[model samples]
Target chain A: MSKDAFFALGLLAGLMIAAWGLGRKAFKSKHYDEMQLKIRATGYRIGFFTALALMAVLMLLFELDCLGIVSPAFALLAVLMVSITVFAVYCIRHEAFLSVDGQGKRYIALFALVVLCNGLASALRLIRGEALENGRLTLSFGSPLLMTVAFLVILAALLIKTVKAGKEAAE
Target chain B: MKNLKMKAARAAKDLSQEQLAAMCDVSRQTISAIEKGDYNPSVNLCVAICKALGKTLNDLFWEE
Candidate 1:
């Protein structure tokens, strides 16, 4: 297998292991409380529409021939990441992102790891001059960067919520 | 419209939001939101909270 394929498989395996650690709490509505389920439902709705809007924008950009730098797959992946981030941030703010039995510290640690790993991968690709093809950003650069940004946003949200909850509990 | 009645009832029972939430099998944030009028809980949750606080639906959730 090619290097990229091997790396992708490894990353997929790592993510699967993390998800398994989270178990049924990883987006299973049955693991959430009633209010959390409701909030998650709204978050899903918002994510769906956000994805729809982004796809429309991508389509418009394609029609206008403005999507020259990035490949179609990168563009689609960016949209997906953005929508998922939005949903996650929304649910985090509403105190519904984590399952009822889920620990906030675990998620915070996971997101932090995601941000770090992806950020370092993107940086390494950039340094190796492997992030561009014919002066257009390639998936190697864009994918990891997008994942870093998405997870960074989620980590920030979770941190802020944790701090706020701490203060509230102190009060 | 904060649910002062529920808060008062909880206070009377010497129960904190976290304790009440634990008893109701919900998150403390859920109880806080319900008390702050930020969320109108489902009837089932209302009943659970009422039962946890040792109050009836009318005593805690009924509007004046």
Candidate 2:
């Protein structure tokens, strides 16, 4: 695989670690309640449908971009923005933060760390005339990294929330 | 649709919903929901609440 894909794989590993941490946090929080369970079930249902529709639209857009009717840069940015927005709304509405207790704060800190590292990497690429073209900071790599981290946070929230419900049921 | 019997039994015991829930190892909301008839707990939870309140299952959970 390409270096970018490899780096994304490593980030994916971090995402899974984050999900596990959030699950552990929720399991030990003592804050999971029945209301949260109903809310999470509804949220996941909504998220599944929303994600499915978004992916279908993205697939069509990608096809158009490949055919040169749409720009790849615009499609990537649009997907990244839409994904983050949808996930943020879903997590907020479901109150994942309540179940995971302090996990929201921890996820934010981790995201900040990821952004700082990505910023430095982008700067290094810019200095070497590698990541910038046409006077535009080629966020070619930034798009995936940001989307991945946002997705990681949402996935962790979903994981912890769902697991908390399952744990309560098992108890 | 009130389970006035359970309410009266709980009052006789002078125990709050939270106390009963703790004794039953459940959330206070679960106890409240049971009392309100908003939820029908399982037989196990019914038995647990009956024991916590020092009443029989029929006294707490049976509908006349």
Candidate 3:
């Protein structure tokens, strides 16, 4: 009935969905070595912990009535989230690269875009003195218009690179 | 980079990625990713691939 409870439930649901997808992928491609499987499993665990930590910190801030206080906890959570996301992406990229043809460029380009977006968003938040807000910090630059344009540009470049690489590989 | 060369040589010998993967105890995706220069194989993996392909490590993986 409470908002916090709803948020926690939503987070759990999202995590479950992610876990299901990852499990299916790992099962369908059972040819991975033990080490590779372990690495993949570790990545998933890291992701879950990162998400859990962020939610806990946010909830605590709300409870303490210092959600708006400019503190190190907010920065720490943001950095941890970014790091975990990057690690997860790396694992996914490795898995996809092994399983799919012509995925190299797409993965790299998407990764670059993600890094760029995170870096810029973090910097902007820090500069605008909005990094320590108790509630969610949404970004105007993360608007649909700018995101769409960046996505289109990255997709086009990835497509062109994939085609060219495919041809070269053939030769 | 050198893994790509090894993969090309293995392919020239009429080996599929799955076959090479089996020899190296890795997934076919790993082999494919290595060949495409998207993933770097460990030293152990490189040695396994070279052995499976019937080439010396240097012959398969040496780069200028």
Candidate 4:
């Protein structure tokens, strides 16, 4: 198997494991609402389909010799977008965002931030003509120094927000 | 946290949390959690509980 194929397989396996863990936690939790259960199930389904689609697309691109080693980055971005869309739909359907609880609002905001970051990164890559390599697109940072700084800033913000949200929920 | 307990006000009512859960289309665990004060039901869920118990939200939830 090619390196790209191996990487794709590894990603799929990791996703599957994470989905299983989430499912198990949902099942064990006594306070999970029906809507929450449905959302969790939908997330698992999306993960499965996303993995399948990624592998299929990667294989096709490889066969066509259109796969750039760096091109998988675009596909990864696409998959992340799809996942965020799925989550947003779930939240809307469940009316989770309308609650007075801060936790729900925080979750919605966090997902929105992720979607925005992914969109910005994708646009930047497109403008720079660096989206794909052979046919495989992998994520790339324009400059190592800049990327590190940006990553740290985002990570810190998210962590702080998450901690505050948890405290509010507990109170 | 308050020690919340969903005690049966009267045995003649004979309503189990499981029965209430089924009537409301929620998992039994949700009902259990609510009774134990471990979970807070959403507005829709609170309404469902009131409907199932033939009582108002104030009767079911508020402490006297």
> Which runs in model 1 stand beyond 4 Å of their true positions?
A1-30, A99-102
Q: Model 4 over residues B1-64: C-alpha lDDT tens digits? A: 3324344531235876557777887755467667767667788998887777677778777777
What are the per-residue Cα lDDT tens digits for candidate 1 across A114-162?
8999999999999999988776787768889999999999999999988
Q: Which candidate model has the greater lDDT, 3 or 4?
A: 3
Top lDDT model? 1
* Candidate 2 residue runs with Cα over 4 Å from true position: A1-7, A18-46, A60-171, B1-4
Instruction: List, for all models, the DockQ compared with the true complex.
Output: 0.75, 0.25, 0.34, 0.18
Residue-level lDDT tens digits of model 3 in B1-64: 5356776788788998878888787876677767777666778888888889888878876776
Residue-wise C-alpha lDDT for candidate 1, range B1-64, written one tens digit per residue? 7999999999999999889988998888888889999889999999998888888999988898
lDDT tens readout by residue for model 2, A43-86: 66765667577668878866666424333453555455555556
Q: lDDT of model 2 at residue A131?
A: 55
Docking class of predicted structure 4: incorrect
- Candidate 3 CAPRI assessment class: acceptable
User: Weakest 10 consecutive residues, lDDT, candidate 2 chain A?
Assistant: A93-102
Q: Interface RMSD for every prediction, one decimal?
A: 0.9, 4.1, 3.1, 6.0
Fraction of true contacts retained by every candidate, in order, equals: 0.60, 0.10, 0.50, 0.30
Better of 2 and 3 by DockQ: 3
Q: lDDT, candidate 1, residue A77?
A: 84
Can you write out model 4's per-residue Cα lDDT over A58-126, one digit (the tens) per residue?
A: 778767877445454445555554554454444333332223132455655654565567567656776
